[model samples]
Target: MADDFADVYARLRTIMLEAAPAMTINRDEAGALELRMPGIDPKTKQPGWFGTVTTKKSYVAFHLMPLYTAPDLADDISPALAKRKQGKTCFNFKNVDNVLFEELSALARRCAAT
Candidate 1:
C-alpha cells in the first residue's frame, strides 16, 4: 500500500459519512467500511438499495447508487472529475489531497441530497 492510501481512504470515507447522517454503516467481511441507506423497493415494498462506499486495493471507491437509479445527473460530471470515474457509480481515488477531498466531498453531498 502507498504511504498515503489509508489517509485517502479515511478522508473519502469521512466525506461519505458526513453526506448521509441517516445512513446505516457496518464493517464488511472484507474489512472495508460500508455505509448504506434504505429505500422502498417499489414493486415489493421492501427495503431497497441506496448508496455505498468502500475501499479497494489501489483506490477508494465511492458508489453512488442514485446515479444508477437516476442516470441523468451523472452526465454533468466535469472533465477533471471524469478522469477519476471507474464506472457509472464507482469513482476511484488513489491520492486524496485537498483538491480531491473537496471534489469528492461535494460529490458525496450532492449524491446524498438526491
Candidate 2:
C-alpha cells in the first residue's frame, strides 16, 4: 500500500458518506470500506447488499450498484471519469484532485438520488 493511499481513500469515502447518509457502512477486516443501501427481501424484509467501495493495492474502486439498476445515470459521468472506469460500475482512481472530486461529488449525489 502506498503512503498516500489513505488520503485518497478518505476523500472518496467522505464523498460516499456525505452523498448517501442512509447507506449502511460495513468495514471489511482487510481494511476496505463499503457503504451499502440494502435491498429489502420484500417478503422477509432482510437487507441485501446494494453498493460499495473497495480499496485495492493500486487504486480505490467506487462501486455504484445503482448503475446496474439504473444505467441512465451513467450518462452523467464525464468523459474524463468514464476513462477511469474499469467495469460496468467500478471507477478506479490512484490519485485525486479538485476536478475529479467535483465530478465525483456530483456523481455521488446522483447515485444516491437514483
Candidate 3:
C-alpha cells in the first residue's frame, strides 16, 4: 500500500468524523470509514449515508452523500478542491492537500448538517 493513500485516507477520515461526529459509523476498519445518518432512512429503510472515506488503489475517495440531494452545499467549493471531485459527490485524492482538505472539511460539515 502506498503511504500516500494511507495518509490521504487518514486525513479524509478525520474530516468526515469531525464533520459528522453524531452520525452512525457503519464501518470503521483498516481502509474504510462510513458515516451514516442516525435512524432509518425513509427511502432505503436503512441508515442514510452521510459520507465515507475509502482507500482505493490509486487514491483515497471521500464521498459525501448529501451533495447528491443538496448540490447547493458545494456552491462555494474552491476550484482546486472541485478539481478533485470525481462525480456528483465523491472526491478523490492521492495525497493530502491541506488547502483542499480544509475546503472539503467545510463541505463535509454542511453535508452532515443538511
| Candidate whose TM-score is highest | 3
* Cα lDDT tens digits for candidate 2, 74-104: 8877888899877777888888766977887
Clashing pairs in 2: none
**Each candidate: what lDDT?**
0.69, 0.74, 0.89
> Could you give candidate 1's per-residue lDDT for residues 3-47 as a string of tens digits?
657777677777877887776764543315666666666787855
What's the C-alpha lDDT at position 24 in model 3? Answer: 91
The 10 consecutive residues of candidate 2 with the worst lDDT sum are: 27-36
User: What are the models' TM-scores?
Assistant: 0.78, 0.83, 0.95
Q: So what's the TM-score on candidate 3? A: 0.95
* Alpha-carbon shift of residue 98 in model 2 (angstroms): 1.7
* Residue-by-residue lDDT tens digits, candidate 3, 1-114: 467688888888899999998899989998999988986889889988888999888888899999998989999898888899988999999988998998899898888776
Q: Please report how far candidate 2 places residue 66 from its true position, in Å.
A: 0.3
Q: Model 2 shows how many backbone clashes?
A: 0
